[model samples]
Target: MVPRVPSPRRPRLPSGRAADAALAAVVLVLVAVGSLRSLIGERQESWETTALAWALLVAACAALYACRRHPVPTATFVLAATIAYYLVSAYDGPLLVAFVVALYTVAAEGRLRMAILLAALGLLLTGAGTLLGNHDVNGVALFMMTGWLVGVVALGWVRENRLALAREAEQRAASEERLRIARELHDVVGHHISLINVQSAAALRRLRKDPEGGPERAEEALGAIKDASREALRELRTTLGVLRQVDESAPTAPVAGLDRLGDLAAAARRTGLDVRVSTDGERRRLPAEVDLAAYRIVQESLTNVTRHAQATAVTVRTEHGPRHLTVEVTDNGRGPIPLGGGSGSGITGMRERARALGGELTTGPTLNGGFTVRATLPCPAAPLAHLPGPGSAMANGEPPRP
Candidate 1:
């Protein structure tokens, strides 16, 4: 036996809280070391003033740990601690790093207005305190600080907007996947289940008519039922397998398309309905999505006829154009077609499938008191050289009467 290959494991990253704590620790060390350099240099400040500055610098850095969770409060605390540290220390340190991080968190948390107000307030308070202390801040120094404050807040705001857009896109993808699964299950299970119901009913009717002779007829119906169930199970397994597939690198099994219309027609014929399938225009390979949509529309139309339409005859037609494929299913059933053009979810699903592929579907009572489902789908195949006109000899594939 071949050796099984293990899947590659994804690298794990630090969680939000752990990352925040790590950031705070790094900031504390950097600020503490940078501020302590003042002691080695010539310093006129007293020992008490130096000790107070170190404590405040550590508090400012530590506040970063709670920045994301309580952004506004953390920003306010860090701002106060940084301001106090600057007032007490003779030399400026990198304590502004923690203040910048806090302001960014505030904006990143979607508190944009508050973050801006806090940023402006920090600049104003720092300038005022520097002036009152008889220490004039140079024009260039104030300009650089203002630039840093504005840049960090703007960056945080951009991050928030990006995160919002990402969430919206993720939600849309999940919703579309749900709809796709619902449509697939309806088409796969609904069609075969309806056929099984009809065959089973026919089998029961045969047995009731003639107990002894009915065995042969009932057996045929039973065989048809078995076939329908097996097909249903097979299609269901394929759909569920796709949903459960963890490895996208593996080859995907092909789904039913227009090529499987023969199988679909065979299943429908078992219900004693004259299901005739005909094609118009050039017949060639179509895009996978288009093929699947066309097949499902036909499958659902046939299913509706089998379950609801009491008519004995139905025609399935596919018209191919250079860039378009039109599918029509008409049944000579006397069943009432909902005035709204859709009786239930099956019709709705068929219309959705067509629309999803930039196509359209129409369902209504045909002029001859029959129900009809028609869909127009865009195909990427080459255009047909000659498309049949309204007065064409074989319009809609129906033979012309001589």
Candidate 2:
């Protein structure tokens, strides 16, 4: 037959002091019941005999109460008292109950080796007392002792299993939270930085072309600032939506790519900078990530030219092929490359974008007394079949003559 599962005992309050009080009261009532039975002529037992029995019962119950707070000490006390009582008289109900409770507590909460040692000691003492008291070696005593040992072992196993399950649940919850945070950072932070890099380059180009066109160039710069700030706000809202129960949709805008290079050039033109864009090879559709990376590299390079190059004209050229897409932004400006200025986060941001797209980017002085930024991006073999027509080239795939 399957053993019935025991209910989990209520946890004792403040070192089991309250549980001890309750156990003490129950023990007194049991003693009173036995005493009253003897007094009412319920049996032929003598007054002294009845009084001794009540005293042993009360002592055993008191030890059981204290066991919750001090398992080892209380178990020791119960063992000694029960053995003494058995030697004087014989085995009884109260003594058995107290001993069993003490054994279970020690096995569940005490160190495993210590609990085993204590159980061995208790068994030895019980056997010795029974032999000395002339109690018969019967099957009943053996059965009772076996049952107590089984109960102790089972209680310890159940407690360990419960603790293990709780720990596993906690770890799973922490892992899920980390994944959610990573997704939010990637989606929101990456988008805004791309927009900022694009607009800044456009402003710098206008400043170089028409040195006297200060008012118009300032207006273009202000517009770029407004567009970037608005994009940042929208990205922030999308990230915050994750915490709310309602499902707010992400904003849909045209993904910046090669098709939009004219608008990019126009923004620079508004700043009084003469900028030209040219393309070659088939303008086939590209992966969204690859397209975004190419656009940002060109944007950041041109932005740098407008800010630092101080040149009259800038050129952006794109070449698509079966194996790769190449982008080059060059300017005939007479300024040294500012590697140590710490004036901007633009260059670091550009490198991060290219790395994200599985591509390489390089920026430095060109051989013809100008600055050039070049990136070679790998493309899929199949998409090269659909490259754009010849008419799509910016300035027919050639830089404007200085």
Candidate 3:
């Protein structure tokens, strides 16, 4: 399998040419300052002193520019050169800025162990040279060196934290988007599929009863088509409500569940399919998610029968337990089942529904020369409120919640 590449997170810095220009300006300023300091008191300075000091100063500034790309190597070269200069002529100025920039780069790009090792080595070399070259190692020098190293390390730490936070936020947003898409797909597709399965069976039944009445069968098919179209419209409205704005309201309607299984079986029977439903365990009110998942599993299986399975009989079995709900739809359709043969929207939609409900779906040929779609969904402890109540509310004389 090919590895998935993660999206790049860091924003690109503006204009490399502009950065180079800025670096050049900084280098010129440093060189001019060093030259002015050298001629502070002397009216007539020796050519040797002037040439040697300015050359070393320009070399140090160039090292700073090189450090931008090759930080560790440039830092080492500059530190070594500065140490040699101090040992020979006891010259020192704002050259510490180059070392600080190099340290920051190393800390940002390298491993913690390597960054700390390089920092310790650089500090030790500079401090040792200062003490040995008769340049009094005062408190001010110690504070400045320590402060630079600390600031660079802190910057690296902050960068790492910000990157981590940004990654977490991206993952969270991706997850939310997946969920929203899943919900929209389910509502939009599930209703129409259900209506199609219903209308097809109705037409098939009418044709079986009166083989000569072709017009009647055609009319039934047309009715089924109409129902499917209306269902599609309803789902589209709901989905548009969600897409428009968070405050937009959706139409309230009954979603198919266990209660609608009987109607589904009756419709299939009308289409000449001998579909039987069996319950093996005690049935209780289940969570809306589990109920909907179970209902869709059976509906999709029946729909497949009408479309692919050239068989007469199909069975839907449901088993409810304390912690789980299991549903299986089986049919004696053909000899060999094409479990992974073709890609169809129905199959994909069913799989997505099962996953959204935190359930598992398996479909393949059975040992007895039949196809079966089985699903197991976790049952919540409490019942769903949206489900229809038992019998008529008026018969019980109970007032509905206001």
TM-score of each: 0.87, 0.44, 0.56
* Model 3 agreement with the true structure over 27-86: per-residue lDDT tens digits: 658745764756666544466756675666567667766565676787677666555555
Expressed as tens digits, the lDDT of each residue in 224-274 for candidate 2 is 667656756765665566556476665485555776676567655644567
Candidate 2 has its poorest 10 consecutive residues by lDDT at 389-398
For model 2, the stretches where C-alpha displacement exceeds 4 angstroms are 1-74, 77-91, 134-137, 182-402
Taking all chains together, the TM-score of candidate 3 against the true structure is 0.56
C-alpha RMSD of each candidate structure in angstroms:
5.2, 11.9, 10.7
RMSD of model 1 against the true structure = 5.2
Candidate 3 collision pairs: 201-271, 205-270
What does candidate 1's lDDT look like per residue over 209-299, in tens digits?
9999999999999999999998899888877878998554543544688767777777888889887778777776788899889989999
Off by over 4 Å in 1: 1-13, 134-136, 246-254, 335-343, 382-402
Give the range of the ten consecutive residues with the poorest summed lDDT in model 3: 389-398
The positional error of residue 288 in candidate 2, measured at the CA in angstroms, is 20
